[model samples]
Target: MIEHRITSRSVGALGSSGVDMSFLLGPAVSSINTVRILAGGGLGEHPAETWQVFYVLSGLVEVTGSDDTHDAPRTIVLEPEQAVQWAPGEQRSSRALVDSLVVLIEATEQIPSARPL
Candidate 1:
């Protein structure tokens, strides 16, 4: 069985940008991952390579993105139990407002919407 300590231990994701990532599933058509970032830590803006969802597990974060719509950039604040999704080719970035844990899902399937953050 695959077992892991997603919160406290590294699951082989290389550390960078003041974030720690752990794998919960695959590196295939779909995958589940966790991102742990301290207050003020974050990922820089980059074009999404696949359908992606970032869900907050604890604390707070602000996600900024400019999607295929090509509209002006938008920022969404997320707290515990909140999330934001980005379509492939969208440019996005995120910053941790407080010590936070976030789950990242990358897939080709249609992800259902959760309570809007």
Candidate 2:
């Protein structure tokens, strides 16, 4: 069995200022991948094919979707154990109101590149 401990030293940058991540379960996992992240008011834009689930370990996150620019942004305050899922083909970004820890779960199998929504 594989077991490990993650610390701040293990986190890496996520293309945004003050956002860091650690891979708890990588692409080697046949079904799913899990990651832990620490973020501070940073924004990230990703393509739509990747489906994701975000669980807040602490603090609050405001999520906005790129598809609906005129729509009001969604503010979700997640304490420990709270989580949310982003549907496939939805472009989303997030920011942390305060220091926050989050867990991201993604499918290990690659989504088809031809489909973008």
The candidate scoring highest on TM-score is 1
Q: Which candidate number maximizes lDDT?
A: 1
lDDT of 2 by residue, 1-117 (tens): 001133233334565556554333335223444344445664586644554555566777655553333455455455554554555676677777777767665654332221221
For model 2 the TM-score comes to 0.48
Model 1 deviation from the true structure expressed as Cα RMSD, one decimal place: 11.0
Query: Cα deviation of 60 in candidate 1 (Å)?
Result: 0.5
The sequence of per-residue lDDT tens digits that candidate 1 reaches over residues 34-70 is 9998999999989888877787889999888875444
Off by over 4 Å in 2: 1-40, 66-73, 108-117
lDDT per model, in order?
0.69, 0.49
Task: Tell me the TM-score of each prediction against the true structure.
Answer: 0.69, 0.48
